[model samples]
Target: MDTLSALISHAEPKANLFFSGNLCGSSSSTDHPAGGILHLVRTGEMLLFEEYGLTHRITEPTLIIYPKGKAHRLQPQTLDGCDVVCANLTFKDSPLYRALPDAIVLPLNELDNLSDTINMLFIEAFTSRFAQVAIISTLLDLLLLLVLRHLVENRICQEGVLSALSDHKLSKAIEIIHKQIDYPWSIDELANKVGMSRARFAALFNQTIGQPPLSYVTEARLLLAKKLLLKGEPIKSVSLEVGYSGSVAFSRAFQRQFGITPRAWYLKQH
Candidate 1:
């Protein structure tokens, strides 16, 4: 699988449509902890207020992405208000969430590839059609994917996993890591696969991804183990599935990373 595909295959984002209409007044994100918040402005103008006293006056059609759990607000610039379709986006345990900026503002016209999808979404959101809600929900999910693609292709992220995926050589290594996470991968082998010397590849990966390759592998394995364990898989099976030699080693690593034992973590969740 390709880098972006592998990345998404491991963690696909979900969107829950919460509001769709003209905003004559203001709206604040009271939902304290969401993976992200998305807004597509179909018409008119509005002012975006973000944390740290940042503000942006948005005109024309635009896409706003708040990719972290940061507070934000929106108010109309005119009495006519702005027509918008908004959703709460959730990317549970996704590395992309940490790589994304506090907020992203992109003019709709700039995203030519999304024009058709955006139009269809606006029509469905405003019309009273059969399964309108369902259709809109699906469209929002698609939009989120497209936005991620845009970010990667455009090199919107300067650092972190997303940025690393944008690099041709690093992306190859990342794809292999995600696709065969259960394999016993070594740094030298990863570098050879990507045609880079061990030192160069290690340095580049660390520079771009902000972590050593092996450290990233451990993180990915543990995250997958966490998911499997949550599904009621036995600890032994989960450990082996994520490339651990035994449950004891996996438990030690899990506790070191999460500050609790695997059983204790799962029990707390239950």
Candidate 2:
């Protein structure tokens, strides 16, 4: 994959990873929730199926990303009890996840070694505040690393220009955009960072990501602006925080992105 697409997965100003697990359930259980699910069965097995046929049989380290909030099960072959470690997770609403499929399973790859990092999420969710949120926060980082490795190692879908975001150069640009959300950026700079010419970067980035480099930069910045605004920053401050030369430019961009003016958005907050 290209750089930018790869970079998007790691892009932060991301959602808090609120759950992880060391759960082992041998009994069949059904779940229907807005939250998504991921499962890894080490010993026995798991069957993930809907009303009719089978969706998946988990005998290995199976990774499922359920987006439709559909009903599914986790258990052994007989539709009865089985051993499984499952994770129920949710993320703060963000634009990036909009690109993922409702569900996909990938090989565990090399990420299994980092299982402890993932296990900590379960600890954080169920445990008291004895340690610190920092531990859970770090777990999220590592969890992201695993998901990223899985997505990269085994990409199921083969559609959409956005999938090209998995490309290396483009992913690099995305990472830069995310890491430096507060800095004003130019396509030329992003292009250079990814070792491409301005025109080349624009065309390739646009083709793969379904948006031009400028739009992406603006989108990334405005997303950050909204986050800052949500944190109670003033309009002018939010504008500057996201790299606008002035609040007016930022306002226009923000309106273009979210369908309302910054002042209106801020007022709604108060």
On lDDT, the leading prediction is: 1
Q: Among these predicted structures, which one has the highest TM-score?
A: 1
Q: Which runs of model 1 end up more than 4 angstroms from their true locations?
A: 31-33
Candidate 2 yields a Cα-based lDDT of 0.61
- Model 1 lDDT, full chain set: 0.87
2-27, model 1: which lDDT tens digit per residue?
78877776676788888898989888
Clashes of 2: 22
Worst 10 residues of 2 by lDDT: 10-19
Q: Model 2: per-residue lDDT, tens digit, 92-173?
A: 3344555556766654554566567645565565567865567666665566555755554555434333365457787677
Candidates' C-alpha lDDT? 0.87, 0.61
Angstrom error of the Cα, residue 226, model 1: value is 1.9
Rate residue 264 of model 2 by lDDT.
93
Q: Which residue pairs come into collision in candidate 1?
A: none
